[model samples]
Target: MKRLWGILCIMVCCTGELSAQKAAGFKGWFINNVKIANSMRTLDLSEQPAQLQLTFPRYQAHSYLVNMGIAVILNNNTTLNYISDLNVEYHRNTLTDAEQNNFSAGYGFKWRFANAGAADYFMAGDLQYLYNELNATNSLGGTFLLTLFRDGKRLNWNTNNFRLNNRLLFNLAPFAGFQMQEILKSRQNGMAGFILRPEFSINTSLAFCKKAGPPYDKLLAIFCNYTGRDDAINTTSFKEHYTQLLHTGINYYLAYSPFEVSIGASFNDGSDPLNGRTQQQYWQVSVNFLK
Candidate 1:
């Protein structure tokens, strides 16, 4: 970790210089944020969910990116499962002269879950191809995720593994590692960079409903992760500094059919120190829709 800090320190000191060499855009946000907290288990495999289906995100053309993609989970059973997705994206230039269209595909398998410990686990690999109008670039990447706890909402895959009774108060365990993360990125004009920073989030599902239901619904969450792996822990004080966002929102499930649709919106407080030594604070709106 010491060596990691040393490299991150150099990057911080030369953040401005580094951007001059490459297009920072929103990518700079990743390097600016770094909070390293230890985590426990990982996995969230609930058989109660839709066994298999096609999934897609809200298509927002107004985004810095106007893109679309679809994903499929071949299985939700204990026997064997495989998944895949294909996405095409267009990145608009927020600064400098950078505009590109990208296409990427990824595949991965799910593990057979056991109730004993961390059960929701998945690992996947990807291949991305990018075209900047001038040149083409290709890169390879993968993701590894594990759920840290057994959600009180679902039965453990192996019921014998968990012998706990559920109560209303036992619901909220603050700072527990129930976060889901994915680091998605690709090379730019043949240059490698963070497409999406590694992110961690925590939230509850308490909502005002017309009928009695699970204690938690309408996905409530707050996530923090670096804008990039460009920096690591240098000083312990650095732990307290970095770019991160807090989101208060609701996820409304629209369907349980072959296709699932969900829409969510959040009031976001985006924080960063790149403007200077002090973190600049601002408020923005985040709306997400996935089908």
Candidate 2:
């Protein structure tokens, strides 16, 4: 009995030490989002002009999305470190009049070089590629964004393992950024033009569950994004421009061993004029696998 007890004590100590080491090393997560929605109304193809006649179905709108990316923790020395994130999202929207598909991928890196007792100084840049296919119309484009922030740090209450601890409390990342969009193709009255955009975004979250005591297990987040783009004509000089829509969404995440699932919904105003003014609402579900 004495020999057995001694072995058990040694094993417990070893496990504790290993856990501590893991907590101290570089931590990262890869996540994905997939979703589907249905439209609230259907267009009347039999009408004189084939106008869109709104009708409520069992489901309002459906959307599918897949976003997979990894974020790395550089260091934890002084709460100031470098972080990098690479993400890609694929979205498909089926509407009463048309079906739209978009693929977007971007990589971003941020540096937290200084924390002036109350605020953190950070700078980030991201480059994204977008491919959009609208029914018979096809458009290819890309965007480059740059942001600078002096955000105050607070405790993040959300418990999701995919998110960092300081994500929920009272942190504010008030940032200003610029985005440039370049269109590559135009067919079926597609808009192929360049736009200079200014954007602002906010991220907030709530903690729901705890897993390993220190790290949370589940989280809920509210994020808002707004972009304003200036019109730039194409080679054909077709005056095609509209104010970009504002987007707001809520997200929830449940973290498991090597995988996690996220669910979210987003609302956006009309950006393009199909027949008249049109608005879009999207609901999404995503599953992520980490290596």
Candidate 3:
């Protein structure tokens, strides 16, 4: 399973810096993901690749923001990770309250620092422009947050970065991050939401790479995130309070190359306002390619 452990490195790749470190120039990466829903019963199944996303980092870095980065994304419009309905009542991003889209482009900035003798830290902000053909909704939004770790790794814009501090060796790498987002504009409506997540993993550094490195090299990573969204918040309509979503995932990365695979599951905590008793759960699998 050494190969499998390498593939699972995608778990600690949350920042993309790890994956980009593996790239040659200008740090770039492409990822494809698919999700499935059990639909409250094992027999009733629905699945979709859901989406693909890529990140490109500029060659300049500053303390306020690391190198500026760009992103392109395509959504397949086939996911229920956001609601309790099988078909969906109101569409929204599974990670945030913003409306969902079929395609999108975005820009972002990052501030990175490290304490070789202690821990690692990261904070970033992102802005996106999105469009959906099916709903004809146009949107804009972004988020800012901080992450904590215990490694001596830094960002490398000229090359893909996979190197991790080998000083600290811990079996289970525990880390957490918090973020807040602004739903600038969603179609013609305004929305609000928040997400909270904490993740943990086993150090799976490629057996061939250094025996010790940051947690990203770990072969297995697991996490659960909570998403709370409300489109009608502070509005006149008292339709419902808000929607709640819980997402759990696992990923594998092969340190030998720039490739990774992942699987995820989600649970909707409320009843679909439209279909009453139709509670839903989702599953997903993803593969990523880095150059």
Error of 2 at 212 (Å): 6.7
Residue-wise C-alpha lDDT for candidate 2, range 1-291, written one tens digit per residue: 243234335433543443354554323311121111121001110000101122346355542222222222223465446654444433344443344454444545566566556445565555555555442323333333333343222332111223344343222233445455566565645465565545444333334454455454546656554444444434433443545545455556655455444555555554432211234554433332222
Higher-scoring candidate on lDDT, 1 or 3: 3
> Which of 1 and 2 is ahead in lDDT?
2
What lDDT tens digits, residue by residue, belong to model 3 across residues 1-291?
A: 232223223222333543354455433324322112221111011111133322235232211101011222223366522111111111222232221323333444444554344544555444544444333445443444444444334532212234344422222222223222332333333332222222221212121133543343445444443443343323322244454445455545444243333343333342222111122454444452222
Looking at model 1, how many pairs of residues clash? Answer: 20
Q: What is the lDDT of residue 8 in candidate 2?
A: 34
In order, the Cα lDDT scores of the candidates are: 0.30, 0.39, 0.31
Query: lDDT ranking from best to worst?
Result: 2, 3, 1
Better of 2 and 3 by lDDT: 2
Query: For every model shown, what is its TM-score relative to the native structure?
Result: 0.39, 0.50, 0.38
Tens digits of per-residue lDDT, candidate 1, 1-291, equal 243234334433443443454455535432332111111011111111111111235243322322233222233354454443232222222111233233333443434344455444433333333333223444443434433344444443222122222212112212211111222222332233333324333333333332333432332323222221212322212333334544344445554232334444433344322111123332333233333
User: Using TM-score as the measure, which candidate wins?
Assistant: 2
lDDT of 1: 0.30
Query: Which stretches in model 1 have alpha-carbon errors above 4 Å?
Result: 1-67, 75-78, 81-103, 113-137, 149-205, 212-264, 267-289
